[model samples]
Target: MLSVKKLEAFYGDFQALFGIDFEIGESETVSIIGSNGAGKSTFLKTVCGQLKAAPSAIIFAGEPIGGKPANEIVAKGIAMVPEGRRLFRSLTVEENLLMGGFAKRSGPWNLKRVYQLFPALEEKRNNLSTALSGGQQQMVAIGRALMANPKILICDEVSLGLAPIVVKGIYDALPKITSDGLAVIIVEQDIDTAMRVSDRVYCFMHGRVSLKGRSADLTKNQISDAYFGI
Candidate 1:
């Protein structure tokens, strides 16, 4: 449902992405894996409209959406759960989730659905967002994005600081999250988790795609070489 062709991005004179070509079909799960400074996050930020690109670079549902405002992109059905799970610490759990619905997009995701997806949030609906544990906070971030009823969900480092078991709990919900044919792009540091959850994987190096292939088909040797730019 989204296609990025020869996409390039820059921060002042220093370019971050180098002619990156990426695409995701309806209901597909794609993972982007790379080391630090590989431009994984930059690519995502550009897609989410935090960074600028040529209007013809990003095509979503057959329309060029590059360089549009972030809110406009969210309204057009793309929502991102950022690396830090940037939740509003001052707001109650419920109130934080409610913020995502400000766009008023119509979809199957709502407060009730989100609660069902992560039952813990329901129990602490009135608690301050920062009062929750790291895992719970990540759930809130995902739920907040879901509240926007997006067609494509972009998750950057969803498992960054959480424990293994907690990460599993969050990852286990992916099937249900994508059951409605919602496309997902995951930028994960954990290669195993990224490979397991996604149908395809792209390895980035030096601001470009070093390798990409079906997750199940890529061998350890190939991924190792590609991941480290061998």
Candidate 2:
């Protein structure tokens, strides 16, 4: 459903992504795994139109969307749950979730569905978002993105700061979230988690895809080599 062709991204004169190419199909979960400074986040930024990219670089549903504004990207059915969650601390849990509906995309995801996906969110709908625990806050972030009813959900470092049990709880909901054919792209530093949740995995090294293949087929040695640029 999405295609990237020879994508190169930069920060002024310093380029971050070097001719990176990737694809995500409908109902598929694709994970991007890499170490710090590996450009996994930059790849997502380019795909989501945060970084300026060549017009022909990113194609979504057969149309070139590279370099389009971020809002326009969300309107076109790509929503990002960025690193750090970035929830509105001032808003209540329900209000934060409501912000996602501003995209106005028609789909199966809605407030009710999101609550069902994370039942804990329902109990705290009226509480201040900042008052929630780290895991609960992460749930709110994901729920807020789902409110946009996006076709492709991009999650950057979803398990960044949470505990192991909490991470598992968050991941437990992924299957149901993707059950409705929503494509997902996950940028993760945890290789084991990425491989377990994704249908396919892309390992980035020095701003490029060093390895890409079926998640189950990649050996630990291969992933370790690619991750460390061996």
> What TM-score goes with each of the models?
0.99, 0.99
Residue lDDT tens for model 1, 11-42: 99999999999999988999999999999999
For model 1, how big is the CA root-mean-square deviation? 0.5
Provide the overall lDDT of each model, using Cα atoms, as 2-decimal numbers: 0.96, 0.94
TM accuracy, model 1 = 0.99
Model 1 misplacement above 4 A: none
Question: What does candidate 2's lDDT look like per residue over 122-189, in tens digits?
Answer: 99999999999999999999999999999999999999999999999998888898998999999988
Clashing pairs in 2: none
Error in Å for residue 71 of model 2: 0.5
lDDT score of model 2? 0.94
The best candidate in terms of lDDT: 1
What is the number of backbone collisions in each predicted candidate, taken in the order shown? 0, 0
